[model samples]
Target: MTDPELPKLVLPGEYLGAAEQFLPGRGTYEDGGRIYASLLGVPAIDPADRTVRVEPRNAVPEVREGDLVYARVDELKTAMAVCTVLSTVASRRQVPGAPEGTVHISKAKDGYTESLAGEFAIGDVLVARVLQAHPGIKLTTAPASLGVVAARCQVCHALLTLGEKEAVCPRCGHREHRKFAKGPLPSPSGAHGPGGV
Candidate 1:
């Protein structure tokens, strides 16, 4: 049978063909008698065996436990801080889907965390370690090396500068407490650089 017309490139879960017409192959899955693309790639059907497959164009970066990652705090709850994982620190690649990660108050710092608002503010960029990668992403900023790497003043929204014991906003002169990561900010270019901020 001749191959059916298919999109040049397909996204994950895009319908491809009927399972009866094309055998499910690599990067394709069969479900309810239908074939679907399993990744971002070009879809094709093998004429000889009638196998449908998607040739991956780019590899998706996987997040794993113990990996260092950069994330932005989106919301602060009583017991946890919700964040969107931005990228993997080592690879410096943006995480696909922008998975949500949470930092429990107990893992916010080394000791007791009186309030999530005290340590993290909305839009604060954090450098945290992945404590759990599956089921749901769990993060930890308790280590001195892992915490808010960049934060803005809550009052004026000016970028805060590192100070003796807290972050200071030059514009508003507002001082805020944070569990700062013990290193310099990652370069705007997404590369790691030296010198503490």
Candidate 2:
């Protein structure tokens, strides 16, 4: 007899095999006497269990309230900074769907924030805690461990190194004040600075 068919890529609604031969698993559905792919993925056949499943490619995790996240400042406003969440700290997976998050000036630091411009700048990457994920994602950097982890020099566009009260650019010697997080900061080599996160 000929060799059995190998698993192959499949699109939604593509027929997989007869339902009697293989039970439908994740990313698959059973219709009539046939199993079909329900998502864009590769069809996996389990000969032992006689099951068929479609493993989706690049499955990203969704954000949730209370999750720590890494985000880049997209826009700075008078009262808030609009940030696009890059990933969640726990899963390290790119946030799916609406990744836009907002951090009000009051939530930027623990004590108080005089102005949003004074505390944050566009393109700054920070660690934050998800305060709300309902109507829209709301973030807070009020904890000592949460705040600007990395930033670029506004004047020279070079990566800023962590300083006592702010970040300083080695290229331009430009010092910028930010609500820096407590503890260690991320370095250019992608490693944590002394005593930093």
Candidate 3:
């Protein structure tokens, strides 16, 4: 019976389909008692039941059409600003190599979003959406639940929020220009599916 403590299952990324469990150690996978697989880019591990689970890894990036995405501002223009994609979903940490995306001022919000400084800033994390993909992808954030998740103060490392036309830190009352949201933001693309997720 192989003792009950001889490392029951394996990891998700280490599985390849075979008799019994085939997931390698530390691969991370999903588990369903009979079969284990990966869930939400990560492997499903009880980390308690000690099971093996894994699934076919999706090769595409996780870009949902109209999904809010946390972005980092790089350059700003008179009306618009060029930016780099930071994260697709809101989490403690961000995914690596998710591809750089953009967010136009017009698509920043539905109302008069004022200057780009009032809405976003350099290295600011913003929640935007994917407006267009043809001739390059165009981004926008006019949704209420699809905005900033967390903004930092320019002076202190306190959390900030959108007050009037700027970000105000609630901790030290330090007003800083940054994007933030209540929770995890949406993806900066209009393609939601099993492709690049």
Candidate 4:
């Protein structure tokens, strides 16, 4: 059987073919006996299987083990810190699927962590490495290049600057302890620049 002609480029919601003719596959959906592209991609038609699929032109980045990521501390408990992953450092793309990660106290620092309170706090921005992506996104800030990159004054909400062994709020002069990453802050442009922090 000859392969059916397919569109070189298809946009979301664009009609592909009748469901009776082609089974909907990746990047496609079937409704009302019609197949439509679900994403911007190239449509592929398999004659043998009578399936139509669209291959996305651009793939969304996903979090993976050992990838560096930027995250904001969402909550802190005695044993762990919960964070919302902002983006991946390498691709500088927002991770798809799972955006939440957990940093166990054991992965917070090098030494024994008495509590997560001193190492992390809500709203603190950190750079961490993905330890696990499936089941759940587990993170680690124990490396020298992984830890808090930016933070705010817990009392005044002012942006804190890097200080000797801690982050200090210039406005409030409040010094908060943290597990700081070793290096300058990640660029605001989302470019993975030199330096860990």
Candidate 5:
């Protein structure tokens, strides 16, 4: 007679009901004839299939279509720029090691994204909408709520005010252009505690 035990897959943590595999990485498990997150990885859970969850290893952050994400500008153009996704705000420890994404100027604000400097610079962080995702995230700042989070003087790196028409550095009087938000946006550099939003 042979013994039958539970379908033990190689990974850790209890079954998160069900899970999905985004990429292949260390400490993963297979359950119900499928793979899922088994460690600190993308926030994926299946409701129907009860399986162990796991995570994959990569380099950059992954950006999905229609996801609100935080990103920093690596480079910019007259109409577009490349962005490195800083992290996922809505979910916990979202995908680890995805890839860098792109932010188009046409989508930089709600009204007219007439100029790139009107919203961002080489180092400004942005809260943006993911309009589409190719190899990289197609980003949008078209929402009134989405745009530059912090303003720095391009010349002197002084902190600037989130003004009605644009961001101005009080110390240097350097004016930065941007599509206006009603008031200042909540700080993006604020620290997030464990399981914090």
Candidate 6:
């Protein structure tokens, strides 16, 4: 039965509960001990087993290999960067499942990367190419045109501006390194760059 206290409807990426309280069932994913809806639908709980799931309202787009996509970095591990896929650059549509994607250290850039943390930070928005779509999503930002398109200053949390050598924060005058995308930089609304918005 659906929980009486939970919302009648939930959108993708909406938090449902802690992992300890309920097991994630179909249409739900657990990350960092939190359960979130993977589809736009009505949320329901199985009282018999303490599982939460979302019943989809409609069809959603699928991520395919070779597609360009925007994703947000959620965590940085030693050899991989964990991210949540946000949208497809072509259609600008939000991925329904908000599926988890990973970028191996080898796929981060064209050359050797000594550290994953140096290339990415939590919350940085990246423009990546899908290397594998099934089993598990794998991404790469190795091309000159693909990489971090938007990032905030680690010190100030203000949007970083493109610099010749690094990303600079206007507010704090902080500078940091990133594997940036080539060509035009995206505006605050993400409407200025190629295939943006």
List the global CA lDDT of all models.
0.86, 0.80, 0.54, 0.82, 0.59, 0.86
User: Each prediction's TM-score against the native?
Assistant: 0.67, 0.69, 0.52, 0.67, 0.58, 0.64
What would the TM-score be for candidate 6 when compared with the true structure?
Answer: 0.64
lDDT of 5 by residue, 1-197 (tens): 11122233323454333334223234555567454446554433333433223444343445666666777788888878788777765553444664576777767765566778656787777776676667567876665667677657887898778877778788888877865444433333222323212
Task: Identify the superior model by TM-score, candidate 3 or candidate 5.
Answer: 5
TM-score quality measure for candidate 3? 0.52
Off by over 4 Å in 5: 1-62, 92-95, 180-197
User: Model 4's lDDT to the true fold?
Assistant: 0.82
User: Best candidate per TM-score, number?
Assistant: 2
Candidate 4 lDDT by residue in tens digits, 37-137: 99998899877788889888886778877677889999998788999988988788887754789999999988899989988889998898777878789
2 or 5, greater by TM-score: 2
Ten-residue segment with the worst summed lDDT in candidate 6? 184-193
Pairs that clash in candidate 2? 184-196
List candidate 2 stretches off by more than 4 Å. Answer: 1-51, 54-59, 184-197
1 or 5: which has the higher lDDT?
1
Instruction: Compare candidates 2 and 6 on TM-score and give the better one.
Output: 2
Could you give candidate 6's per-residue lDDT for residues 89-186 as a string of tens digits? Answer: 87788998899999999999888999988888999999888888899999988766778989999999999997654988999999999888886433
